[model samples]
Target: MNMTDSEKAAKVIEALKAAEGEPAQIALPILNGLVGLVQGGGEAPLEFEEARSGAFLAICEIGKALHRGQPADQLWAPAIAAAERWQALAR
Candidate 1:
C-alpha cells in the first residue's frame, strides 16, 4: 500500500524520536499530533517551510543527543548514511 506524505513524514519523525533523547521530549508530542492531523485528512498547521525547519532542528537535537552519549548510534548511523546518499544524489 502506498503511504501518504503524512505517513512518510511521521515515519521520519519516529526515527528522529528514536534517536533523540531528553531534548526532544517537548517537541515530539506536538509533531506527532500534527502527523495525526495529516493522517486524518486535516491540514497540518505548519507550512512546508516551517515543517522543513522543524525537521532540521529536530535532526540537530538528535545529533546533540548522540554527542551526549545517548545510545542511538545503531538507529541514527544508518539514517545519517541514507541522508548522505541522498545528498550525494542531489549533487
Candidate 2:
C-alpha cells in the first residue's frame, strides 16, 4: 500500500496518543493485551512467544518500509530507529 509521509506521520502520532497511558510503559504488555488470545504455558503448549515475536517483526518491518519508501509487503527493515527512540524515552 502506498502511504504518504503525512499520512504515516499522522498514523504514528495517533498511535502515540492512543498509547499515551500505561500502554507506553512496556511494549510487551501492549502486545500481550492486543493479541493475548494465544496464551499458553508449558503443559498446554502455546506459541505465544512466537506470535509476539512475529508481531514485533511485522511492526518493525512496516516502520522500515515506511521510512525507506519500499513496497510495504515486500520487505521491512528492523525498527531500530523506533526501538532506540522508545528505549531512550522508556528508560
Candidate 3:
C-alpha cells in the first residue's frame, strides 16, 4: 500500500521509539520500516538516497544504544554523519 511522507515518517519514528531499550535485533524491524518508506515513494533517486541514509542512521543508532547503554539522541553520531554527507551530495 502507498503512504504519504508524513505517514511513513510517523510509522518509522514509532518503530524506532518502540525498539528503544530493546536488543540490537530490534533495529532490524526499524530497518524494514525505512525500506518500506523508500519503496513506497515515487521515482526520485534523491528520496531513495535520503531514506537509505536515514535507515543507516537509524540502524546505527539502535545498535549503539543496545550495545552501549546510551540514549537514542546520543547514539545518532553515525546517522548524523551519514545525513551530512547525503545532504551535501543532494545539494
- Using lDDT as the measure, which candidate wins? 3
TM-score of each: 0.35, 0.32, 0.47
Instruction: Per model, state how many residue pairs clash.
Output: 0, 0, 0
Cand. 3 TM to true fold: 0.47
Order the candidate numbers by TM-score, best to worst: 3, 1, 2
Question: Would you give me the overall lDDT of model 1?
Answer: 0.45
lDDT of 1 at 2: 64
lDDT of 2: 0.37
Q: Write the per-residue lDDT of candidate 3 for residues 1-91, one digit (tens) a residue.
A: 7655545555555555665555656655555555555343345576556755565655656565656655665554454444444434444
lDDT of each candidate versus the true structure: 0.45, 0.37, 0.53
Candidate 3 residue spans exceeding 4 A from truth: 43-52, 60-73, 76-91
Predicted structure with the largest TM-score when compared to the true one? 3
Candidate 2 C-alpha lDDT tens digits along 1-91: 7543233333433343343332223433433333222222234113433433443455555544444555543322233233333233323
lDDT: the better of candidates 1 and 2: 1
**Residue lDDT tens for model 1, 1-91:** 8665545555654555453444445534533443332232344345543444444444555555555656544544444443333233323
